[model samples]
Structures are given as structure tokens and as C-alpha cells.
Target chain A: MVKLAAKCILAGDPAVGKTALAQIFRSDGAHFQKNYTLTTGVDLVVKTVPVPDTGDSVELFIFDSAGKELFSEMLDKLWESPNVLCLVYDVTNEQSFSNCSKWLEKARAQVPGTSLPGVLVGNKTDLASRRAVDPAQAQAWALGQGLECFETSVKEMENYEAPFRCLATQFLHLYREKVELFQGLV
Target chain B: KMKTDLCLSSEGTEVILATSSDEKHPPENIIDGNAETFWTTTGMFPQEFVICFHKHVKIEKLIIQSYLVRTLRVEKSTSKEPVGFQQWIEKDLVHTEGQLQNEEITAHDGHATYLRVIIQSAFDHFASVHSISAEGTVVLNSS
Candidate 1:
């Protein structure tokens, strides 16, 4: 049994459903709510998901962090252990989307050890009618960050599984291929 | 009536609370030149933190710990506009023994776009802000 630990960062505004999304992906019977108690410190939750083809179970340690400036000191600690990053933003708020660059910069500075793969999540997509962020703009921002972006609605569960599953799959695939290549050389 | 007061942090930018015991490392104190901050409820001690969200919000209860805040004020801005601000007066020392105390103040007419907390003048310790958690609720509504 291959044991792999995956770390994901849920970076977004206070009530943009970052914690809700993490809970949905990581735990069973996770409920979605309108109001969430703002995360003051770094919140850590772990979940195990099975890879389809390989049948290997990957344990994901998801960190839902506070977006306030007071918690900046803890970024290095969170970055040190994370294998993947999820840069979340609110679809209804353009400023949240605009701040994505700042959040990305912080994440990059923390994880200098590896080219940490990131997923741009436009959360609360169910409120797209009131969306201030256009898909094209969000996509362009993702391109500029050299990361893949997807819009998700935790309320409606739209494209919910795609973002988490895609990131997990990519990490597993790359790890397996690299190990095999190194073994063949040895 | 032995009542306990629990100070909690609200979600918004501007205005923070600090206890007398937490002076060395307050909430919004960033390191070096890197300005980064996070909001937290659980720490060494409990103090009430209030932030003025530029947008209107519905708050149910105002809970404070280890502190007796007599007046709660909500101002439009830092400018000295006396008309728009509101305050409440009370005489409750909510703490008996040196333990974590919790107080619940539910609002029947307490809805605000901005919030500020003023502890009774005798508490000895003041509040501190960690960092502003502005989620752009201001810009979107104004625009």
C-alpha cells in the first residue's frame, strides 16, 4: 500500500465558503451553510480518497486558513508541508478574485522547495448571476499564475468533484511516473 | 448571578480588541516588513473584537469573555460624526473567579454596517486589532 499525504490550502475571503468546501471534500455528510464562523487560525482536516486505476488511497490534509494579515506569520509553517495549493476566491466579489495574485504570491514564497501545483477555485458559483468576476478574467488570471482554474458551486455542487479530483489525480500520476523512471535508472 | 464573558472576533476590516495580558504579541502585529494578519477566537486569553464591515450584516449575539464591556458603539467612519453612532450603557462585571467567562448579548435591533466595542472605563486593559479582514464588501456595494 502506497502511503501519500496531500496538503491543500483554502485561501479566500472570510465567508467565501473555503472551509465549507474543504468539509465537503474531506468528510462524509458535510453540510453547506450560508454563514460560517470566520477561521481565525489555520484549520487542518484530513481525508482519504481512493485513486481509481491504481486503487491507492491518498490521505489529503486540507488547511483552511484565515485571510487576515495577523496570520501571515504562520504561512511558512503551512507551506513547508503542503504538496498542493488551492487558491479559492468568491465569484460574486471581484476584489476577492483580484486579491488572488496576492494570495498566490504568499503561497509561492512559502513553498520554495518545490514547484507546488495550484488549483484556482472560483467558489460560490451558484451566485453567478450576481458574479462580479467573469470566467474569461478568472481564466486569464489562472493562466498568468501558471495554474489551472475551475469554477465551483458548493451550494449546488456544480463541478464540485472536478477540482479536488483533478489535483489529486495529477499528483498521484506524476509521483508514480517519477518513481518508475528513477527505479529503471537504478 | 455569576456570569462569564467570552470575547470573540468578528469578520471585517478595521477595529480590533486586545486584553491587558496580551501586550507582547497582539493579534494584528505582523513581523519584519511583511504585513500579514489572521483573525482568531481561541488564544491564551479571551477579549471581545469588533470590526466595522462596510456592508450591512446581521449579528445575533455579542459574546465577551473575561471583560465587561458597558458600551457598544457603531460608527460610520473615524470622522467625529456623533449622529450616526450608537451606544449602550450597562453595569455588569460578568466575572467571579479567575476563569474563562462567557456573556451573551443578543440584539433585537442591533444590525450594523460598522461595529465598535467600548469596555467600561475601569477594565484597565484595552483592545488591539490584528489585521483588517476586508472582503471587498465595501467596494462592491458602493459601485
Candidate 2:
């Protein structure tokens, strides 16, 4: 079985729960951040997600970055050559949801020539009463921008793995396509 | 259209993990592109060293310069990290009297990020691997 590692950038607005989502995913929902900790720079976490039915796995080097611009220069050192992206937003904050475009643009600009596989995630859906970003709207925008979309509440630990699984699936597809070229040699 | 040396230390490839290490003979010698410097196994059989490329590469062939290596095995991992290895190639070397045993193996495999070369058994108690080189092209992608 081929286990491929890809760089996954977790980016969104501050307080959008990108860190919580990543922590929950890594810890298997065993722990949640009780207090909001200001992420000053990039926190790297590696996890392997098994590709369903393929016996292959993608090791995600998830670089969870701070949303604040004060660390842009420092973040760039870790953000270079990202393989996949997870742009997160709070369903209760429209501004956070809209900023997904800018976050994605910044990620793509790091490596300009090639296509980056990514996903748009609408986080904090447990606050359904304060929902400001429509799921259908987010999904439509994601489709137009060639990104898959999903909604999850990391606070409630619901549907947190879908976005990462989606990214892994896309990367696995790219690996298979590239491997096909080498198959012709032998 | 052009093939490059994928195992050169000057080309961003490094020996991340190795089973044995000697002060005079380190695993880095395997990719240093110099056949004079070599990594010698201190003891026992089944010694291995892992080579990590800058990125996933489609190798055309792998060449190893060693002495007294009887059975050698090669494993490949596509993961960005050194994990999830699947067996790729295993070869029995042609032992030499006092000369270096040079074995060249071809590639009929997919893209690889790390290659683990295991020296399962040797003709002598200690074996030395001078260098290893892979002729391939890098798979260019954003990730």
C-alpha cells in the first residue's frame, strides 16, 4: 500500500474554530479546547487518513496557521508548497465565510504554476440559531471555485473529518493519475 | 525528456533514517555521489537506510555500489513522510573477491517519496555500501 504525505493548510478567520477542528481531528475527538488560545504562528500536526477501499493512505502534514496577519512573514515559511487546503469559516459570521476567497488566493499564490486540491468548510454549525452563511450558497461558491464544501461543528465534534477525507480523496486521485504515466515504463 | 540523478545529496535528497551509523562511515555517503566514501554495517544482517527525495519521483532505475552484499531488498513509500512502505524489489547480488559489487535495478513502479534499502544478508560479517543513485524525473505538483 502506498501512503502519501501531503501538506494541508488549515486557514480561516480568527475564532472560526479552525484550530478546534484540527485538534479534534488529531485527538480523535477526545479533547476540545476549553479556552480560545490565540495561535501565534503555524502549528504542524501529522495524521494519516485511510483512503476508503483503496488500501492507500494520505499522511496529512496539517499546518494550522494563525488567522492574524502579524505572522504573515513567518507563516509563509511553513506555507510554501502546500498540497491541499482547508478554508474554514464560522457559519455565524458572514465576514469569516466571505474571507475564504482571500485565504485560498493566498494559498495558491505560494505555488503559482500547478493546481491545488482543496475544500471549503463551514464550521460551528452547532450554533444553528446564529447561522449566517447558507450551506447551499457556500457549496455553490465552492463548486464555482473548483473546491468541495462541507459543514461541521467542531465544538460539538460533528462531521469534522469529512473535509479532510475529501481532500485526501482528491490527492489520492492525483497520485493515481501521475502513477499511470510511470506504469507505461515497466 | 531529460533524466536526472534523483539520489544526489546536492539535489535535496537526504538520508533521514538508517539502521547503522559509524563516525567514519555514515549513511549520508550513500547519496554523496562519491563512491570512495561508504557506509559500513557495524554488525548483523538486515541493515536498512531510507532516502527521501525532495518530492515524489518516478524512477527509471536504481543503482547500488556495495561489497559483500548477498541479498538486498528495496521498498518504496509514496507518503510525504517515511511510512506505509510496500515491498518493491529484491535482488541477490553477485559476490566479488575483492572488487565492489555493482548491481543496477530497473523501475517498474509508481511515484515514490522515500526508498528503504535493506541489506538482508551479506557474504561477509561486515558490508559496505559505497553509494546509491536513481535515474528519474520529479513529479511536479503544487503539493
Q: Can you tell me which runs of candidate 2 are displaced by over 4 Å? A: A29-41, A67-69, A184-186, B1-143
Total clashes in model 1, counting residue pairs 3 or more apart in sequence or in different chains: 24
DockQ of 2: 0.04
lDDT tens digits, residue span A12-34, model 2: 88899987888888888323212
In the order shown, the candidates' DockQ scores are 0.01, 0.04
The per-candidate count of clashes, in order, stands at 24, 4
Model 1 / residue A88 / CA error / Å: 0.3
Candidate 1 C-alpha lDDT tens digits along A1-186: 353456677776677778788766655543322223335466666666566777554556677665543465665665553567788889999888888888788777654534667789999978858999999989997988778889999888677666777667666665565333322321
Q: Give one digit per residue, the lDDT tens place, for model 1 in B1-143.
A: 22211122332234444332222334443111112222222111233444444444444445443222223332333222223655542435443232323455555454455554434321211222222222221222222
